[model samples]
Target: MTGTTDTRPVHDGHHTVGELVNQAGEQLSQLVRQELALAKEELTEKGRRAGRGGGMLGGAGAFAYAGLLGLAGTGVAALSLVLPLWAAALIVTAVLFAIAAVLAVTGRSQLRRATPPTPEVTIGSVKADVEEIRERAHR
Candidate 1:
């Protein structure tokens, strides 16, 4: 025979069901770890967005308070340029409100993008792994 052979029994040299089961357990553990990581990342991103949005909302509240003071000619009149106090106050109020609107909108959109924190890809992969294991077990 041109081919060389290692004279070993097939079952002794090859993998067995016990080994496969152990490997499957290891793989399952790894998959769970990966899924947990994904969930953590997702929640972290969402939490950051929520924090930024809340901060922007707080900023909007502050600006609105300042606007009220501007109208009352108490806080913003000194900061006015060549324009009259009321006109400058109105202009500052409008600009502050516009910036708040933009921040609020941008923050809201970021928050919306991270609604559910489930690891969808990992879930699907686990389901498929279960199905494959079931099929192989049947054989």
Candidate 2:
């Protein structure tokens, strides 16, 4: 007989209960961390959208104020001289108001898009993960 022998433990595709339990715990921890990270990312994106919408709304307000100033100039021009000067100022004021209206509409749409800031996708993923874990646990 040859004097050489291999002395490695064979793997039988089975784990002890303690090892399984430990593995399950680690997996659960990892799943929770992943879910939290996903939630954080979703919330951060919503916050950025809200900020942009708010800034646009602020710009609309500023434009509206400028429109008010232009209307005041139109009034002064109308009182001082003929229709041409006042008509030009009125046209400028109308353009300013139109721009403000456009900005207001755009900002409102952006705000609507950012509404209901919840981690909906992450919530659904976590619910699915729970169901899967439950089914496996039963098995």
Candidate 3:
């Protein structure tokens, strides 16, 4: 028998170089698409959560304002029992303004704690992959 190896096509045929490259390209494309879809999903979820949080904050602020108004009304009612009606109203107004200022400061701090929108890991990874593809293409 000849001492030569059989490099021909076998029962399970080997892919050509072109076929292998095409398969790789297709896989890479699929991976990138999946990553992008995941990123979009994450961003949408985060946006929804942020929206809900903002709505809750707004509701809280409205409730606080209403409470302050109620307090002022009570103050006016109390002062009216012992002083002139107009003087009582003015005092109530001043007290309400002070409460409003305090609430404004607190609301501002809560808003400051809110985080800005940002890309998550999926987006970052996709970007890295794109950069790598571009670099490889250039080379």
Candidate 4:
């Protein structure tokens, strides 16, 4: 047969069965190496995106802290009209603390979600391919 594939070099139909098996082994080895590379690339891209998002979250937290400080100052100024200065400042401090607590909990949840960046989809695809190959070999 004319078996001159880009990957396999089986010329003139003179290759023995053992030689063909050896070629198959070589192709399988190459396929495995390429698949591993794809998995690594996919996982790396996912991790990079998650890391960027986490940095944005940190930036948000910082800006929120600054804004909260400004708002607390404004609240104390407004409330000081009806109460003593210390009581108004205390009220504003309590409210600001509550907001900070909420944001800290939410940030923790997001950070937990961004961890353990594995290529799950690629792993499943590779498993399916391996099973298909096994089935065909059985036939």
For each candidate in the order shown, give its overall lDDT on alpha carbons.
Answer: 0.77, 0.84, 0.86, 0.88
Write one digit per residue (lDDT tens) for candidate 4, span 8-115: 775787887888799879988987898899899998898899899999999998998799789888999999999999999999888878977998999899998885
Model 2 weakest lDDT span, ten residues long: 74-83
Taking the tens digit of each residue's C-alpha lDDT, what string does model 2 give over 1-139?
7898777555598877778899989989999999999999998998899899999999997998798887767675764575576676766677778978998999899998874668899999999999998898899
Model 4: residues with Cα > 4 Å off, grouped in runs: 1-17, 105-115
Give the better candidate number (1 or 2) by lDDT.
2
Those runs of model 2 whose alpha carbons end farther than 4 Å from true positions after fitting are 1-11, 68-116
Model 3: per-residue lDDT, tens digit, 1-139? 7799887666467888888899978989899789978888888998899899999999998998799779878889999999999999998888777967998999899999987776677868888888998898798
Per-residue error (Å), model 1, residue 84:
26
Select the stronger candidate by TM-score from 1 and 4. 4
Q: How many clashing pairs per prediction, in order?
A: 0, 0, 0, 0
Best model number under lDDT: 4
Better of 2 and 4 by TM-score: 4
- Give lDDT for model 1: 0.77
Which segments of model 1 are wrong by more than 4 Å? 1-13, 68-139
Candidate 1: pairs in clash? none
Q: Per-prediction RMSD in angstroms?
A: 9.1, 7.3, 6.7, 5.9
lDDT winner between candidates 2 and 3: 3
